[model samples]
Target: MRYAVSNQPEGATFQVWRGVLAGASASLVGIGLARFAYTPLLPAIIGAHWFPASTAAYLGAANLGGYLVGALSAGALVRHARPATVLRAMMLLATIAFIACAFPVSFAWFFVWRLASGISGGALMVLAAPTILAHVAPSRRGFAGGAIFTGIGLGIAASGTIVPLLLREGLRQTWLGLAAVSLLLTVIAWNGWPAQDAPSSPVNEQPKAKSPPAPALRALFAEYGLNAVGLVPHMIFLVDYVARGLGKGVDAGAQYWVLYGLGAIAGPLLSGHLADRAGFGRALRVALVLQLVAVVLPVIASGAALLMVSSVVVGAFTPGIVPLVLGRVNELLAHHPAAQKRAWRTATTSFAVMQAASAYGLSFLFSHSGGDYRLLFAIGAAALGVAFVVDVVAVARSK
Candidate 1:
């Protein structure tokens, strides 16, 4: 593969593009297979009587808890480990977790695997972006970033299709089958990434003269944390709520989940494009409004048509929020790379903790209420509304 050299900015070629593809593949391996595969599997595991709804919720929370741990440790891990090593190891564990779920193991054992999977996924996320930056050309970074993130969408789309088909064989077969596919993907993404984490570019290495305002920290941290709470409904219950709760078959739920994936695939590209014209703050506010409306619609409306629309809108916001929020963060930290990296790590930590806590809290609520999916959606909507308010206030304060 052709490597970009110090004097040859113009030499960025197909080799650079291949490295970007590797980063994207890592994304698919990490988020797509690890995080999203569970959503589709939630209903199947329940149907097989592997766990009750409430217990299933705890398992999901355990995965996010692992993510929180991973996110918190990401910086230190990068310092001590190679990006490729971390990526490969995490992908292997995630693949193992997928297959482990296929066994009729004890709940404690299953939980351990899920948590391991979450840790792997979270670290992969923290590692993948920087790996790309180290390899891709400057002019191509934006496209590269989009490609990597879009892996989540692609993985979701694949799970939506592959899981449903495999379930026809049996839930255990589905798990094993998915594990096989994940193993293949891990190998491919491993090949695509650079052998080292040595960044050719100094994207975040510049020293800043001054730190950002405290208000900047408060605004971003709050926004990031609350954003995860707003997403708990769909993340934990969207498929099950439709299939088991609403009396729709598993296939219908999978179909809607696919729609959600399709929305996710499109959301980042479209939102990023709009953010350019309208500005990140303005674009994000619009998305929050859309997301809030979408969250509330399933409770208000009764038709399949409206449900599909809500799924797409909700799905769009889930992955879509990353670019929008990161854009706003960049705006705040433009002059201070050191401050920017520091604040982003803080924000990421906040995000992981909030998401993990909400997963546990909501799962317990669902159990106590005997699986009241509507209540969960309402709570999610309320959280999104609060996030919208925080964002609006932040924009106002910036002015």
Candidate 2:
């Protein structure tokens, strides 16, 4: 009879922490610095005469568009290349983009770099969690996932907090500083990845194919799309909305973003814990409710304390929902791992595409609405409301 024990090497536990940190660093550099940094930096960019404020929507959309392209590319790249190699290369590219943006170039030129940044961000978002999880024993997978997901919040918080302080030096210096930080994070994470890996694994595409029903699948796709729609206001304009929309200065706005980031740090761990006890579907519903509240709160209340709560909830659940949906997908496809892989790719792509596409639409709406972010927030809240209903239906059907 064989007795069960962890098959990990003696130092595996130690390396797991390193891998976790590495994964978080990936998030920090990609989502934290490369992608979401635009939020706090948007006002600074405008103030520095780098670009017209009118182009904010296009700029945000460009990043999301590049993110979509990156997501599609990852699906192909995984088939032919090593994930570790790909992950590191993307980090390096993101670092370069960050540094390059320090130069005040044409709007078109800066747009290209932002696009590249988004692509790298998208790739890392898809890749990092799996890479980190590979280092942990199966029993601790949730912990690994939580550890990895926290990187988004960490990055968000860093941007919210650090970018404001650095702006005192000037926006150009801020970009240079972010680029250096990105380089450091990339190096640390690169070294933390397993020195060896199988030629292919879950992070890479393997042919496992199953199709859920068309209507149910469509509903899931819709929820994925709306998730981004509900999120764009906070992601792209939270700082500006607070500063310009609420009559707060940029500093106050950045402070709110920091609080938001702090809340984000709690989201994934609590979400995972909740999933462990209540089931992924139930936990997801809880997240959706909180997210809905987060979106609607700002529209209904303007007080300092209330808006702070709104910021926290938005920040927390913004990155929180992704893992929960991925968890649900895994559950939905428990019987067919191959199909699950395909489903995940589909869900992820749909989500990215919606996010990319929605940027243009929603931004146009905001600009057209005479810059009344309340209208924007209202629309965003409505999107979340639809997501809530769609999610409830999808969860029931999945059951």
Candidate 3:
């Protein structure tokens, strides 16, 4: 079960890729299936009379609340358990959550399981890439990080395509099907993690009360949080907007979701390659600009072609921004893995907090404004604009 760090060329390459697969599996199950699968199912759940609209919406938000909890506690959990152990546990927890969700015994029951799924996702998000990347060579870490996050895209793609097909059978069957897939992935990744913890460096081994995070790191936290706000509109409402708001059928909305999934699949690899070639800072800035435009596209124009573009572009950046921000953290804290983990954790927590707040806030706004999808998109675009400006100013000041 142990994948010892190997000295031989082929052995090292295999080991790195194995760890990558494990990390990807964790992301795929934890974030992709656990968090996103719920989105496509939201309407179905409401339609089937499983829950009323308001309760169903609150249940969706429960995951976000639990995610914030997970992000805040991931480090402490790792301190008590091996990263590999923690990763496996979280994956199992996600699988269990999926199974538990099939019953829909009561509002409280669904809420608890949904929240647990989010916790699994948040913990995996915080821990997976950094742990796996710790064993990868620095020169190749960008690509490796991107590969790991591809699981998220894969999950999204599956949610769009597979969930709808599964819905044909029944909601309970769909949940069970997802659990089967998650369990299979969990088994595949069971032994791919490195056997030992990442080697500690002098920088991290210093006294606990070291200097505060650098200014750039601080700015990154804010920018990342803002990016979360920017993404909320599409993440929460894309399918709904297309299907309900735009007067398109659910099938058409699913098609748009599929396109979004396609963009997501390409986004991380492209962004990672860009980070390798151009640097994480520049890659992040470019991503922000692209995301800003994508978010605003719907507001400016809602043609079929333009809506498709918005879906794909915004979808690409949804999960795409993750690797960029993670890479930027690594770049900023090079040779300081512990610090990088801490900074990444803080960034993730910030993202989760903002995402949860914005999801609810935007939902409230949409409800109050008579389900104004354009207004939601406009607000998201504004958030991205602010994030881009903040990042630019931070980079200038750092220079």
* TM-score, every prediction: 0.83, 0.85, 0.93
For TM-score, the strongest prediction is 3
lDDT of each: 0.75, 0.76, 0.88
Q: Residue 42 of model 3: what lDDT?
A: 88
Steric collisions counted per model: 0, 1, 0
List model 1 lDDT by residue over 3-82, tens digit each.
64443245533255666666667677677877877776787889889999889877877777888777677777767876
lDDT of 3 by residue, 1-399 (tens): 124555434555336778899998999999888988888898899998999998998898888888999999999999999888999999999999999999989999999999999999999999999888877766677778888998999889988888989999999999999999999999999988776766664555666644544888989999999999999999878888988988998899889999999998887878888888888999999998999999999898878999899889888877888989998998888756657888999999999999988988998999899989999999999998999999999989877
Better of 2 and 3 by TM-score: 3
Tens digit per residue, CA lDDT, model 2, 126-223: 76666555445434555566667888887788777788788899999999999999999888887676654422335334465445455666676687
Model 3: lDDT of residue 328: 90
lDDT assessment of candidate 2: 0.76
User: In candidate 1, residue 331 scores what lDDT?
Assistant: 61
Q: Candidate 2: minimum summed lDDT over ten consecutive residues — where?
A: 1-10
After superposing candidate 2 on the true structure, give the runs of residues whose Cα lies further than 4 Å from its correct spot: 1-14, 55-57, 105-108, 134-139, 195-218
Say what the RMSD of model 1 is: 3.8
